[model samples]
Target: MSQGKRTSQGKRTSRGIRTSQGIRGGLLRRHRDFRLLWCGETAGKFGASVSGVAMPLVAVSTLHASTFEVGLLSAAAWAPWLIIGLPVGAWVDRLRRRPIMLTAAAVSLVLFAGVPVAARFDRLSIELLLAVALLTGTAAVFFQTAYSAYLPSILEPADQPEGNAKLHGSASAAQIAGLGSGGLIAQMAGAVNGMFAHASTFLVSLLCLAGIRHREPRAAMTGPRSSSLVGEVREGLRLIAHDRWLRTLTLFGAASNLALMGYQSIQVVFLVRTVGLAPGPVGALIAATGAGGVAGAFAARRVAVRIGTARATLLFELGLSVFALLIPLTVGGAGVLLFVVGGFCVSAGVVAGNIIKASFQQRYCPPELLGRLTASTAFLSYGTIPLGALLGGALGTALGIRTAMAITTAGIPLAALILFFSPIRRCRDLPTSRRPTPDSTRPPAPDGEPALPRP
Candidate 1:
């Protein structure tokens, strides 16, 4: 694949620009913009990892929140996906992604910084924490929706897999490092100070984004003028509902996320109360799970190439998710290994699956519909997160954390059945190109998968 000349918005305007003219021949070796993007994401992800630990610690330690309230905190953070996701997708298609990203980062930076300020004034409460989580989550919804559609314009199709691998790998590494450091920060300076650390990462990300020189195409600026928001959103929904592959993946993602978040919602409380772990140790253990994600990121391409992407996906989704059942069996000695092993497998599997699927979608879907496609799918997938959190909290409050964890963790493997019964199960590799079918309800192709639907 060839590199292109950049516009002012960090997007490539023409495909004729050459990277091999000087010492820039190697892939991503000389891609200045991509390198900056990678750095920014790594920094941002690190901050998120720290906040992941600090947020719960503050709830459990300082506020003395109930197990159900912790779960509610988790729910509040993700509720925006259900509420504003569809409209945001429509808006993202109409606006330049970089500006949206910048605005989201700035907002998140301010909001997170406010937590510590509130704490110092003796004014922090569960309501304030929940509100901060909800607002930050809303910003994330916009930023993430925009970023998914933005990546394709910055790199050639052939370079995307490698780019994704690098970005995912670095992000996992950041998470691992951040988790350990975050725990230490919580133990030393208190959880409120960790918010200050989280706030700093956003500043780093914003600066990196500001340094990018390419400009996006004018099409993004004016293309949606002819269409209404409802019309555009409907088109996105239609694409997901009609396409068999997308339909299957979206369903599987939703179910899987439901189970994943269910367990994650109460994992900290379980480890602290049931497993008898301290805050610092809890952070270290969570970081250990992220080590698996790092491995998964680096291993994703190799596994896909060796076994075929389709088969590898099942192994990751089904085979690895089974280990999640071990989590609730932990006793406090060498038995802690059960929780570590189970969480690691699940984390690895999910991250690897995401890498493969993201690359597939980028290759298979039309560029114009990418934003809507991402939003529509996430609307269902991440939409389940709040529900899962609520379910987990309710179950924990009623049946006890261990039993609730067991029931939820078991659902992870069960979620894979959606894919196992779909066309994805019979294939070795997912389709790379879209084929026009005479009708949406037509039979599967000779290859065993249905034709890709068009927007």
Candidate 2:
């Protein structure tokens, strides 16, 4: 193999950007292919951010959905990852990523476009809108799995954190910029045209992603195809489960997500009823969370590097656990202040977890397994959100909104507990790689066995 040849899709990196990959002992590098992939994802994710605002607005303002209906719209989009994650991951492993990713972008774009077309024809319905969201969410599962699997190929291990920072940073920044701008755009263009805006952004994302080029393995990542697809998916599930650290983290993440969904389900209600805030400040409060997220993404690297990603994750989670308790402490507009502080902490923890988890997964996994494993992790962890949201809504209805939220906040401490007990929290020494193979699909680390962290 060409020694230390860093290559990926058309990722343009500055010459001054250098770090040492443990494998090559070369200066840190970001390969061109990874950069292109990162850029494409960043751009598309921005579009999704727009959709986040535009979709709800369409449901609320145009369809005149009740609060419950609006919540349903959000839930529908998240439902698929829980439902389709594992199967889709296995499928993604069987295909070349470039084509699948492009197809996903195209399909998602058309789905968004349909909202405008239907409305222009006076045919827009809430059912049709929710269907569109569901399908796009499914597509997102595939595109994301492909992207994750494909990322490890272009850089040394050292560059993984930096490269991911760019990709994730773009996403965080987009949340801040896209949501506010989409709201403004929807105001001027009307809700239907606002839907069109998301489509346009997705189209631009498609163009950016299509520009990148890289060779992918012709066959599936697994050595031999299983006789059944379910069997294949099961293999992935078993792998993640058997990896003690991954399992712990996966549970923690799932718990955290459930709590977040529960909180979000009632956030507006709490803001309006408990905090005595109007709709405008409710929007501002939500938007402010993105600002904190952006800041966290920027700080992720230094925090992870100094404390080691796992410890940083634990520390961040602890902060979240503490801040989450303040949600029910609504006293004389104190709720808003508490929420802002909690939101910041939540954003920081989530971003920090992504940095740590992705790097950890990237180190141990082979290119082909990316789709299956990513899907497995997400499906297991993210699948609970809808249930959580539903439970929260019911609890709020029964116990009062504030009380229900107080119960939901309890998950943070559980997540913190999981992290505190796991070996991942203590494994601070970075893993090393001695080989120069640029294949994104890779063999196991720790000499062909799982890098199972000590408990």
Listed in order, each prediction's TM-score against the native is 0.91, 0.84
Worst 10 residues of 1 by lDDT: 14-23
Q: Summarize candidate 1's per-residue lDDT along 49-126 as a digit string, tens digits.
A: 999999989999999999999999999999999999998988888778888999999999999999999999999999
lDDT of 2 by residue, 1-455 (tens): 11134543232222211244321221223355665676667667667767777776677668876555655666777788878888988887777767888898999988888888998898988899889978988888788877787666555655676767667767877776766666667667765676676788777777777776666657646466678889879978877766665677788888888888777766666665667764445555666776767767777777765665656777767665677776667544544777777776777677766876787677656555667888899898888776676766677767887888888877766667877877655555333332336432222233233554344
Which residues of candidate 1, in runs, are more than 4 Å off? 1-28, 221-226, 436-455
Clashes of each: 8, 13
| CA lDDT, every model vs. true structure | 0.84, 0.69
Please give the lDDT score at residue 331 for candidate 1.
76
Off by over 4 Å in 2: 1-31, 186-192, 220-224, 268-281, 328-335, 429-455
- Among these predictions, the greatest TM-score belongs to 1
